[model samples]
Target: MTTAPAGPDPTMQAIGQAIAEGRAGDTTSARQKLLSLWSVIGATGDPLHRCSLAHWLADLYDDPAQALAWDVRALDAADAVTDQRVQEHHAGLHIAGFYPSLHLNLADNYRRLGSFEAATEHINAARTHAPSLPQDSYGDLLRGAIQEVAEAIALRDRSRRASAPGSTA
Candidate 1:
């Protein structure tokens, strides 16, 4: 099978830059940049770009509702992402590897919103997809997060975890 050119994607670089801006505490400009990119990318644009952008965009907001909207967009775009598309980014990457994090984020948002049932559903989904993760620190992190969110779901904890992905605490 022929491999795609190994050049970095400019769109992804832009998204990464925006994410860095947010992490650097310039969330407003980061959000603006991501939204502007979203406007250009549109809903039907590159699923990988949409998924990555929406996933990071969700982190820019502290509000569960707002974050939930972006998380949902990320999940939807993830569904459209093909394994080939993911492999194009990196040879070892797979679309299935994206689900655990995507679902975990959704579960966390739903839990914070006090939607216990929905949170439970997504946490379960995350668990089911956990096996797709590589046996590395990243995989361990997601597995640990899955357990943490599942515990919170069972406890009916509506409060945000200090360790939650988007938490500044």
Candidate 2:
């Protein structure tokens, strides 16, 4: 007999799914649902709840500047989740596990707003944290994402330099 892998809190799972739905193009409904969940989770909720809600909520905004604000909140919430509390809320979760993705999102948001320096800073942080992730598919995916973002940043830099005055292709 096969056992299903344990998941996060039911509320968190639902919120995550709603965020995925938003990512998959149901922004209007997903935003409403996420806002509702955020209300239930509250500001002083469990650290895990706050982290998950804020992380997912970051993506709901059309404006990268607004999204970056939510990303900062998510990172703060993740940092607030101590090891003891992590074990209590979800055995598999660790603050280290959240860093790469959080940094990646921050990098993307910064890049979107044309803040290349800040974006590169977060990308470097993400790369530093990448190896600490579990040696699993998700970890691999995050690493891939980090590489992709790095390449994109490099390409953007090249393009910018190429277009600068007195610059040769």
Candidate 3:
């Protein structure tokens, strides 16, 4: 039920700076800044803000389990976004366009956690939605990343089965 601010929030600018810091290898500073912003944004803030914050926060965690929790929060927040809100927050971007990347992140997190079943489920979801993404360089990059993750999961599953007890290979 939370509504987005009428205009861009200054805090979002700080969050962007934090993201830049993270990209520049200052993850510790980035995380600290993001944590501070999260405190201001609160748990019940605008869905777009929550989704973006949670998605970025997930990358700051080294543990896949913790990252998965943040990814889940991001997805849940994304689900709450209305079309009107999407127009307000992201202009041309639709909520549906976010799903493929979210699923890919979830799949990667699940794979790192050794939950192959969950990983495959999200990987399939990512593939299902990949075509709906904008046909641009970013979309192409995401598609390639999705394929790479899928291959990694397949390789991991194969190794897992080969090492399992009573394997007939």
User: Could you say which candidate leads in TM-score?
Assistant: 1
Candidate 3 runs further than 4 Å off: 1-7, 157-169
Q: lDDT winner between 1 and 2, please give it.
A: 1
Q: What C-alpha RMSD separates each model from the true structure?
A: 2.8, 7.5, 8.2
Model 3 quality (TM-score): 0.84
Q: Over 4 Å off in model 2, which ranges?
A: 1-10, 157-169
Per the 3 Å backbone cut-off, how many clashing residue pairs does candidate 1 have?
0
**Per lDDT, what order, best first?**
1, 3, 2
User: Which lDDT tens digits does candidate 3 get at residues 6-110?
Assistant: 567676677788888887777788888888888988888988888888888888777778778989988999899887887776466678888998898898889
My TM-score estimates for the predictions, one after another, are 0.93, 0.78, 0.84
Model 3, CA-based lDDT: 0.78
Q: lDDT of candidate 1 vs native?
A: 0.90
Candidate 1 backbone collisions, by pair: none
Q: How far out, in Å, is residue 43 in model 3?
A: 2.2
Model 2 vs truth, CA RMSD: 7.5
For residues 106-153, write the lDDT of model 1, one tens digit per residue: 999999999999999999999999999989889999999999999999
